[model samples]
Target: MNDDLKAAVLERCRRMEIPLVGVASTDRWEHPPFLPWMPEEFYPQSIFPEARSVIVVGLPIHLPVLETSPSIYYHELYKTVNTLLDQYTYRLASFLTDCGYPSVFVPRDGYGSIEVLRKNPVAFFSHRHAAYLAGLGTFGVNNTLLTPEYGPRVRFGSVFSAAALPPDPVLAEDLCTRCMLCVEACPAGALDERDYPEGLTDKAACAANSAELARRHISPCGICIRVCPVGEDRERYGRTTAAGDDDPRRRRAREHVRKYGGL
Candidate 1:
C-alpha cells in the first residue's frame, strides 16, 4: 500500500475542509460483507478497470437546516451539499491523476432526475455502500450510512484511483440503534421496522413522494434522517427530542418557510 499517497490524500481533504473521508481497496468489493451483496457490475473495479483504491468523502447536513423538510430551505441545502461532493470528488480525482495515478470521480447522484429514478430507482454506483466499505460508517434502518459525526444526515461522493492507498478498517461497531424512528416517521410508508435487506426501503414510493414534492418546488422529503437520533449532531444542535412539529412556534416557522418557497 502507498502510505505516502494516502497521507497526501488526507492532506488534500483536510485542505478542502472535508469532514469525513475513508479509503477501501478494490479487492474488498470481491468479498461480500453481508448477504445479498450488490452485483459485480456495481463494483468500482468493474466500472473503472484501472481503480485499485476507492476514496469516499462525506459532507454533513446540518440538523437545523434539515428540520425544514419538504421546504425550499432544506431542498437548497441538499443541492448545495451534493454539488460540493461532486466538485470535491472531481478535484480529488484530478489531483490523484496528476500524481501519476489515473483516477476518476463518481458523481454524487448518478441518475438523471427523480422522473428517471421513479422508473429505475438504482444509481449506477452506490456511494452509501462505497462509504460503508471505505469504513466511513455503518448502515442504518433508514437505509442510510450512519456516521459517528453526522449519522444518516451526510452525503457522499467517491473517487476511483489506480493508487493502492492504505485502506481504513471497516467499522466493527454498528451505529444503528434500530429504534425504527425512521420507519415510523416515513411519510410515504416506504420503510419497515426490520433491519436493512429484509427492510429495504420502497424506492417506488420514495420516488413518487419526491416527484410530488418536486412539483411543489421542494424535491426531497428528508423526514427519516431528521427524526433519527443517531450521531452527535442531534446533541450538538440541541435536537435531542424526536418529537418534531409539536412546538407551535417551530411548526409555524416551518409552515411559513414552506409557504414562501414552493407552490
Candidate 2:
C-alpha cells in the first residue's frame, strides 16, 4: 500500500477544506458487508476496470438551513452541494491521475432529474454505500449513512483510483440511536422503524414526494434528515427537539420561509 500517497491525499483534502475523506480497497465490494448488497455492476471496479481503491468524501448539510425544508433555500443549498461534490471529486481524480494513478470521478447524483428518479428510484452508483465502505459512516434506519459529525445530514461523492492506497477500517461502532425520529418525520411515510437493510426506504414513495416538491421548486423533501438526532450537529445547532415540537417563534419562522419559496 502507498502510505506516502495516502498522506498526500489527506493533505490535499485538508487544503481543499474538505471535512471528511476516506479510502477503501475495491476488493471490499467483492466481499459483501451486508446481505442484499448492491449488484456487481455497481461496484467501483465494475464501473472503472483499473480501479484498485475508492476514495469517498462527504460534505455536511447545515441543520439550521435544512430545518426550512421543502423551501427554495434548502433546494438551492442542495443543488450547490451536489455541484461542489462533483467538482471536488473531479479535481481529486485529476490529482491522482497526475500522480500516474488513473482515476475517475462519479457524479454526485447520476440521474437526469427527480422525474427520472420517481420512475427508477435508483442511482447508477450509491455514494451512501461508498461512504459506508470507506468508513466515513454507518447505515441508519432511514437508509442514509449516519456519521458522528453530521448524521444523515451529509452528502457524499466518490472517486475510483488505480492506486493501491491503504484503506480505512470500517466503523465498528454504530452511530444511530434508533430514536425513530427519521421514521416519524418522513413526509412520504417512506421510512420504517426497523434497522437498515430491514428498514429500507420506500424509494418510489420518497421520489414521488420529491417529484411533487419539484413542481413547487423545492425538489427534495429533507424532513427525515432534518429530524434525525444522530449527529453532533444537533448539539452544534442547539436543536433540542424534533421538528413539529419546536417553539412557536421558530416554527412560525420556518412556516414563513416555506410560504414564499414554492407553488
Candidate 3:
C-alpha cells in the first residue's frame, strides 16, 4: 500500500511539475523546534491523531533571472513559488480526500502576530528543515535544503494523511559544516559565528534583516544564495541583467530601456 501511494504521489507531482518528493512520519516531527507554532495538543498526532504519514513536496526556485536582481527578482520568485505550492498542496489534499484519507495543509506563512513571534522565537522552523526531515534534501550552512539536483533553490509544502506509508529516514549527510560562505555573503549582517557556530542558525536575525531590506528597497540581497557553492556549480543557474554592469538597483530602473533598445 505504501509503495502504491508513493508511486501515485510521484506521478501526481510529475504531472504538476514538482521535481522532488519524500515522506516522513508525522510522529517524528512533534516537538518544540518543529511544532513551534502550535500547542502540544495540536501536534500532528493530536490534531490528525490518525495521520501516520506525511508527503513532502519540493518545488525548485532557482531561476537564473532572479540572481540578476536579488531584491526584486527573489521576492517575485518567492511569490511565484508560494502560489505554485498552494495550488499543488490543495490538489494533493483533494486527492487524499477522494481516496478516503483525510489531510490538511500545514501553515506555510511563518510569521504570525507579535505575541506568537515573541513567545515562539523559533516559531518558524526552517521550511527546508521540514523538507529535510521528510528526507527531501540535506541541510546546508545557509539553513536551506540542498537537494542533489537543485541545491538550495526550492520551496517546500507537506500533506499529513491517515494512510499508513513507509517513512523515509533522515538523510545521512549534514552538508553544512563551520564553513560560513553563506554567513559571509549576507550583506545584512544577519548571520554570525556565535549564532550558528556549527551552522544551526538564528531565524529572528535573518528575518529582521530581510524585513529591513524590504523596507529600504535597496536591491534586496540574496547574495547568500548567489554565493552558495552548490548553486554556483549548477550550469542552469544564470542571471539576466541590464547592460553595462551597473548596480542592480540602477539597472532595474532602465529595464525597459534594455527591453526596447532605448537608453
Candidate 4:
C-alpha cells in the first residue's frame, strides 16, 4: 500500500512539472552518523506528529536568471518561484490527505524577515536538510544544497506525511569544489570555507546585510549563488537553447549597465 501511494504521488508531481523528487525516512537525523539531529521544534515529527517520511521536491531556478542576482530580475524570479512552491506544496499535501494519508507542507520561505532570523535562526522545518536526506544533493561550502543537475540553482520545499514511504538513499558524494569562491563572493563576508558541512556562516551578518539592501531598494545580494562554479557546465546547454538567445533578461541587464554605468 505504501509503495503504491508513493508511486502515485511521484506521478502526480511529475505531471505537475516537478523535475526532482525524493523521499527520506526521518531516521537519518543523528549526531554521529549523519549531521546532528535538528531540535525537536524543527523536526518533521513536530509539524505532522506522524511524519514517518518526507517528500522533498526541487524546483530549478534558471541559471541565467540567477546569474543576475542582486538585481530586480533575479529578485522577481525568486519571489515568483517561492509563490509557486508554496502553492505546489499545498496542493500536494491536499492530494495526500484526500488519499487518506495525512500530510503537511513545509513552505519555501520559512523566514518572514531578517528580524525573525535574528530572534531564532532556526525554522519550524528545513527544506534543504530534507533535500539532503532525500539524496537530491549534499551541503556545499556556502551551506546550500548543491544538486548534481543544477548545483545550488534549485529551491526546495517538502511535504511531511504519515505514510511509511520507503526512504531514498542519501547521497554520499561531495559536490562542492571548495574553491572559496562563495566565501569571497559574499558581499556581506558572511561565510568561511574552512568547513564543508559545519556551521561556517555568520547568519546574523548575512541577515543584516540583506536587511540593509532591502532598505536601499536594491535586490539582496546572493553573490554566493552568482559565482558558484559547480553548474557551469549548464552554460554549454544554455547556449545550445536557441530560444534563449534573445532573452529579455539579457536585454534588461544590458540596458541597466548602459544607463547606470554599473553591472
- Candidates in order, TM-scores: namely 0.97, 0.97, 0.75, 0.87
The predictions' CA RMSDs to the true structure, in order, are 1.2, 1.2, 5.7, 4.2
Greater-lDDT candidate between 1 and 3:
1
lDDT, candidate 3, residue 158? 73
Q: Give the TM-score of candidate 4.
A: 0.87
Pairwise lDDT winner, candidates 2 and 3: 2
In angstroms, how far off is 134's CA in candidate 2? 0.6
Clashing pairs in 2: none
lDDT value, residue 140 of candidate 3: 69
Off-target runs (Cα >4 Å) in candidate 4 are 30-37, 236-263
Residue-pair clashes per candidate: 0, 0, 1, 0
* Whole-model Cα lDDT of every candidate shown, in order: 0.91, 0.90, 0.63, 0.76
lDDT of 1: 0.91
Compose the digit string of candidate 3's lDDT tens values, residues 177-226: 44566778676665656422244556576566655655544233566665
- How many clashes would you count in candidate 2? 0
Error of 2 at 167 (Å): 0.4
Model 2, residue 46: C-alpha shift (Å): 0.4
Name the runs in model 1 displaced over 4 angstroms: 243-249
> TM-score of predicted model 3?
0.75
